[model samples]
Target: MSLTDDAHLPPGLALAWGAPAKSNRLGRKPTQSVEQIVDAALELADADGFAALSMPKLAQKIGLTANAIYRYVRSRDELLVLIGDAAWGAPPDRVADAPDWRAAAAIWTQAMVDRCDVHPWLCDLPIRGAPMTPNLLGWAEAILKVLTGAGLSPSEGLACALLLDGYARRIASARRDVRDSATTSVQPAAVTRFLEPRLQELGYSILASMMAGNEYSDEIHDADVTFGLDRILDGIDVLITQKRSSV
Candidate 1:
């Protein structure tokens, strides 16, 4: 029935959580459902971009008047909240069964990156704050559960989850930029090749050495993600180890 007693709750958010809404249709039974609306919005976003999603465009796509669409969703912002939750959907299953927290956390974080792969527009959504919606919070809870099980306190676990969340966001942002960049954009490897010979001529032997074997040159991809995960998880491991020692 009612999702919450608080009347201030936005209709779209309540509907996203499967909560009942304040019916506004006057003497007319609904012709469509919120799920259908959200699904169409998602398809529009996936095909175009998040910028193309608006009440008017969505209405045209779904055969509803611009104003009529408001009968299903309150506003553009509310629609975005629903889209985000839908985009994230749910966390990877069985992450909790991993042999260790570090392994589980790795699976969880990479899964976030993979989600962005499906919906590249996800990275464009401005993160107003921490995860609060059903699906997003489910992701956070999954990560926090693993970290807390590894002997981290609740606060410590939350902080670690934030770290992992930011890491995933950054990775997705980098991937999106590279994907959306101009065709003429120079990749790091190309730049490195261009700079290699000049680097030694400019008294930059160390720079030339790293670029000699392409060690310091490559496009951002899973390798970078693995490198970052290793360092971040290593730091967390140190903390967990210390907590274990003290206990």
Candidate 2:
């Protein structure tokens, strides 16, 4: 369905598409635009995390009353959808001379990771449903095109796209978790020190050995993300190979 099709669009989705909510105006014209509200919301989320996006708080940041904020958004949930869509913006430009579908897919997935790095709050936003916003659907379309170009059926291509998208999100979420933990509580170094003495008694022999050898570091998380992403791509390669063989 088209992004602008409002025949049966959900209220939150309509808002994402800039559909003004039905408003009963009383006095003067509203001061803030939906774009302004979403921008302020993004700023607030970036500064204070997604949990800090209450209407009152957002209004305070935007220098508007809480009720005035509702003129642009129906509720926090709708506002979140708007913020997410705006933050995601547009997908990466398609590489005109990408050598293979795998290269194209890698570029697409890495772009998503880079986006999440910029807006780590994206990991905190709850997944209400599948991609409905223009940019999100665009990203999905790009990946699906790559997969289908590699010989997968549309259904298979969609499945593979979903797999890759999920993998990207998982890596982003994991990165967010590490970031949040570092800011809020005990640092990883301290945690490692605390756990080093107890690992043998706790029966985590491999973990204990790594800790004992001073092998744990932030780079390990980066390595894990690379390993997981490459492994998933490798599996997709097997599927693509089988599809070509059957043809």
TM-score of each: 0.90, 0.84
Give candidate 1 regions above 4 Å deviation.
Answer: 1-7, 182-193
lDDT of 2 by residue, 160-222 (tens): 888888888878877777666665555667878789779878899998889778686654266
**Each candidate's root-mean-square deviation in Å?**
2.4, 3.5
Name the candidate that leads on TM-score: 1
Name the lDDT of candidate 2: 0.80
Tens-place lDDT digits, model 1, residues 108-143: 999988999899999889787777789988998999
**Global local distance difference test of model 1:** 0.86
> What is residue 201's positional error in candidate 1, in angstroms?
3.7
lDDT of 2 at 193: 79
